[model samples]
Structure formats: structure tokens, C-alpha cells
Target: MGQRTFAEWLERDMINAYIMSPDSALSPLFLVERQKLESMLLGEQIKNIITCEEVDRKERHEKLEKWIRRLEMTGFEKVPLSYNGRIEATNLLQRYSHKYKFKEEHDCLLVCWSDRPLFSVSAWKFRR
Candidate 1:
């Protein structure tokens, strides 16, 4: 599949921090390796950066839902790596208003997607 991986596309966005949840635990050695990769992409060594976030399962769950809602607000319907812009999928990164948040500090806004349909973004689903 000659397509850009998420990390590849992410590099173009140049987001300040890419938040890896505490749930995705990695060994110290592996974590170091990942930090190295991140530093390479960022062009700086962000040493002493906090690796783990202190959040309860409940809060993590809540935050995840909130992000999904925002993503749905973006009006993108295709999956990120394969989205073609007419298939009725959802994307959340588009900012219609003049104001948007761009993090320069070690903070990132995290989002995830599943098998939701296009035209689902920027709208709601109601079921009984």
C-alpha cells in the first residue's frame, strides 16, 4: 500500500508533542529508543520530559470520548491514512474558526478513530 503512515503524515503537521498514553507502557530501553526517534523528528533533545501521565482510568476514558467528539466535529469521514474526501467520514483536525490551539510546550491533543463512516464527523449519531 503506497500510502503515508500516520507518523509520516504527523511529521508534516509538526505537532509539538505526540502524546502516548500511560496505557501503552514500554520498557525503559524501548522508551529511550522512542524518545530518540521523537527527538530526531523535533530536531531537539527534550530530556527530562515527563514520560508518564498521572490519570485514572475514569478520566482517561472521559478524555478519550471528548476527543472523539471533537474529531467528529471536523466533518471528515474517511479514515486518516486512506481518506479520499468524499466518502462520508470524519476528521477533527480541520479548524473552521479563526481560533485554534497550537501547542509549543510539551503538551499535545490526543485523538483516535475506529470504524466510523464518513459524514459522521461534525455530526451526531442517534440510535435506539
Candidate 2:
């Protein structure tokens, strides 16, 4: 659904929410890394498709705080991430390259490559 419509629903009193999004500030780095990884691990056709998708996402992406503001404006408050969830996420990442890591900030969990944030996961609940 469109963001406007989603916000309208939240304003009308939707309950718990979770969002997973690409971190726009670091998207350029992610796109480059993704392209390199794809080129190495996948075929040429898949790599080309991923490149196109990354270009489109890069054009459309917005900063993480923009979303926080949008949700907060609609009466949604940030929810603290769970310790178990964080532990699970960390364990999951260990199955891959060690360059991947997570950082918790502003009540959100960010997945990063080295030091650059690539994606964010956050939870929210309507303020009673």
C-alpha cells in the first residue's frame, strides 16, 4: 500500500507494527557491495537483474528518520527491540561473512557491512 494510506490506517488506531527497510544513507555502499557479491556468487543474468533493482531502490529510498517521523506523527511510538531477537539476529549473521554486524540505535537494529549501515529493523506500537 502507499505510505499515505498506511499512515491513515495508523492514525485511525492500528496496533503493533514492525518495519524492515534499507538504510538510505548507506544504500550506495550496499548497492556496490551487492553487485560485487552477486557477480562473484551468482550468474551474469542474476547480477544484471540485481543491478537494475538496486538502481531503482537507490532512486526511491529515503532516510531512516523520515519513516520514524511518519510513524510517530501517526501516534505510533518506538518499541524496544528484544534481547533474544538481537541474539538470534547476531547468530544468523555469523553463518555468513564476519564483515556483517548489527548496531542498536534509536530503538532500532541496524545491519551493517563493516561500519556502514545497510538495513534497519524497528518495531512500533500505537500509543494508548
The C-alpha lDDT values of all candidates are 0.37, 0.64
Off by over 4 Å in 1: 1-16, 19-22, 44-110, 113-128
Q: How would you encode candidate 2's per-residue C-alpha lDDT over 16-110 as one tens digit per residue? A: 11112222345777767764565445433332433457544333234688889889999999988889989988988876667779987777888
For lDDT, the strongest prediction is 2
Per-prediction CA RMSD (Å): 17.2, 15.0
Worst 10 residues of 2 by lDDT: 12-21
Clashing pairs in 2: none
Q: Where is the poorest 10-residue window by lDDT in model 1?
A: 112-121
Per-residue error for 34 in candidate 1, Å, reads: 0.5
RMSD of candidate 2 to the truth, in angstroms, is: 15.0
